[model samples]
Target: MTADSLPPWLRQPLAELLRQRGHAWLLQGPSGLGQYELGLALAAAWLCEQPEEAKAQGACGHCPSCHAIQVRTHADLCVLMPEVAMQALGWPLDEKSQADIDDKKRKPSREIRVEAMRDAIGFAQRTSARGRGKAVLIYPAERMNNITANALLKTLEEPVGEVRFVLASEAAWQLLPTIRSRCLGFTLPWPDSGQAQDWLVGQGVPAADAPGLLRAAGGRPSDALRLASQGQSPKAWSLLPKAMSRGEVGALSEHAPAQAIGALQKLCHDLMAVDCGALPRFFEPADLPPAPPRAALARWSRSLASAAKTAEHPFNAGLMLEALVSEARTTLNSASRRP
Candidate 1:
């Protein structure tokens, strides 16, 4: 769907972006804040053959230009992303790369390859096929390694013809400062709680469950909707804090090792928040056993942060789960006791 068709929570950001002028822009924020959606909308609006007002808002979403983008056939737009991301977005790979991947010669890459950057450079120098110049959209732009990023640097330094660029990133700090310096930056805004809950209901989340789902996702509406749509039941999620407190490894059995660790990380994060006399972000405070001492929760936080680095490739998932839960039990038990 066109960006204009996204949830209403995103409309203000899209409009704010449209009002700005830039040859290149960096849209940076944590995930689920709609950087990718807003970036794509900006590109579509730039290339739209429609009237100026339409350009100043969002794509008409009905023009041939908008339809082309909808179907990924825009002649003057280039999408630079990791092969896996490209595939997921339905962007076609160059013919040779497609062949190699299809023939099992290689797997889709997780990082943007240098070859793809080279192709984009060539795309930049060409005359506009659609007479709207050209637009390059790089998503998770942090995926570009040094060589690929360096190649892109030359284009940003001296933008060719009418070419424009939008770089959307979840981790802006990981990019080269030179790259960051060449573009205007916009930080995505988090929607208000009422706005988030309303959007969640509009996305088909049960009205009664909206608050819990929203809280579980740390107030990111898109993430909350994603969890609801992905079948994360409220009851199952509500039970997590108490289960973890009891060392119930089975409480996390439904998640992959990495996902399980993320859940625990959130759990630890909320416990620390409670210890500081703040409300919990992920779980209902009453659902938690008790807040551990600040010192104990700090250690738990550090341990979980370290575990996150390699949680994806844990050598023994079962052992890791057991150890994690046992630690949880010790910490929670300590919290429940009087000095």
Candidate 2:
């Protein structure tokens, strides 16, 4: 995105990070804190031909290097994301990998494959194709399985030419300490509330609705924008508590099984908070129904967690969702037996 369109909060950090020097970096923070965006910008700036200009104001958005990146055609950039993520980001897979996926030879791997890691290691060793140095941007680095991570560890430990690494993660603790020790670490900064709200408004979220969405996202602006983009609105979200309490499945029916379960999990979370006399974080307190019995909430929490483990590979999505919502209904409608 152009500097004009970049979120206000990310501007300074992006600029500051670009000015620093490092062959490898670990950008870690909780989900929705812009780790991926920051990592991409840092990589682009590194590969940008206009170093002086990019250093001052992030990537020069219109340069050939920047344009190549925007199109996912940058010769010197290797983005090592999960196959699913690579597909989502419009990054093309290697020809053989693409053919395999196209022919349904195997399912798209959710974990970065060892094969991809080996290719990246080779890429890192090659001379920079664009005269600028090479960069490997791995987002949600936690997704690397142990075997794949081990393959990348050697390259991370020792420098090979001008190749650079930017590993961005929401769950940094999942990484091997040895892998982490090889890179400089930068924790992402949380944006100020006012700044986030303003940026949300600028991104087409209604000004009045921004605060509620922002709160629903637990102050994560990227998540708030995603919620809005996915047809969620503040009003609809506020109605979720009461909807779940009444066993109304419609509030969550439109979402995929995983997403629906996630919303229910949040509702369960808030109900637990209300039971403990604490204000809710993801929903407006006044909009919530009376809290469920602690026993029921706990039971449902365990069940939801179990379901989350297999939510991605459900045998029958409709049945799975029905079962999940039914379980939620039982817990939400239960009452405390305590005097």
Candidate 3:
């Protein structure tokens, strides 16, 4: 996509980043804040063929370089992501890797492979295929395991030729300190609620569902859009807290174990907030049951956190969800007996 096509909240940041001079940049923040989008936009601006004046606004959408990126065929741009992310984002994998997976030799990797990093290092040393420079974009940079990160260290520290790098991550704290030390760090900004809501409507979310979805995502617009795309209705989200209190497993039955646990965690968080005489962040006060005792809520919160560690590989999703709901019911019922 063109740089101008990025979300409104990211445009100003794009311009700001373009004006800076850095061989390597680290764009970091929580998920759903467009770290990947901004990184790609910056890459495009660096490689854009447009005049300097037009480049300041971001990439010229009509340029050949921009089109190459749009179609994922830019010879000078190397994107490092998990195989799953590369496939989902429509970036073509190297022929060897694609053929291996096609032949069922092995499953696609979830982490950045060292082999890919080695290839990228070689690419960085090559002359620019186009008149402009080269770029390497790495998303979820934390996905790089130690071996892969180490492979990239030398190249990042003392780059050769006219190449630039942008590493975007949702969990920058997980990255190697050396990797973080080599790049200019930029944190993505959080858009205000009104701007987020308007953008959601622009993305075709029903205006009526915007507020509830926004709350469901903890005010992350990209997450809100994702929730809408997943068929999570605003009404169902609003009912989730009370449904858990009543021990209704079916309310969360459709979700994977990890997602179900996350929803429960948000519910637990809101209950704790209300117990402490503060407004809830994920659910409306009226939608929540009466506040449970702080001790009970705290216990439930700890359990949820522990469960989250293994939520991705539950022994039995059915049993796990039932137990989670049962505990929620017990904690929520404590509110009635608090007197």
Best by TM-score: 3
Selected candidate, larger TM-score, 1 vs 3: 3
Error of 1 at 321 (Å): 3.5
Q: Indicate whether candidate 2 or candidate 3 has the larger TM-score.
A: 3
TM-score of 1: 0.91
| Model 3 pairs whose backbones collide | none
lDDT of 2 by residue, 1-339 (tens): 445446777778777777788889999998888888888988888888885764576777888998999999999999998889999878899999999999999978888898999999999999998898899999889999899998998899886999999999999999988889988999988999998899889889999999989988888999999989888878888888777666677778888888888888888898898899888878888887777778888989999999999989899988887788777767766754433
Q: Which sequence of candidate numbers ranks them by TM-score, best first?
A: 3, 2, 1
- RMSD score of candidate 1 (Å): 2.2
lDDT of each: 0.85, 0.85, 0.92
- The ten-residue window of minimal lDDT in model 3 covers 1-10
Better of 1 and 3 by lDDT: 3
Q: List runs of model 2 lying over 4 Å from the truth.
A: 1-5, 51-54
- Structure candidate 2, residue pairs in collision: none
Please report the candidate that would top lDDT against the real structure.
Answer: 3
lDDT by residue (tens digit), candidate 1, 1-339 = 355576676677777877878899999988777777888988998888888775666788888888899899998999999999899878999899999999999999889999999999999999999897799999989999999999999899898899999999989999999999999999988888998888788878999989988888888787787788767777888898888777788887767777787788888888888778899888887788778788888888888889888896799988888888888788777886635
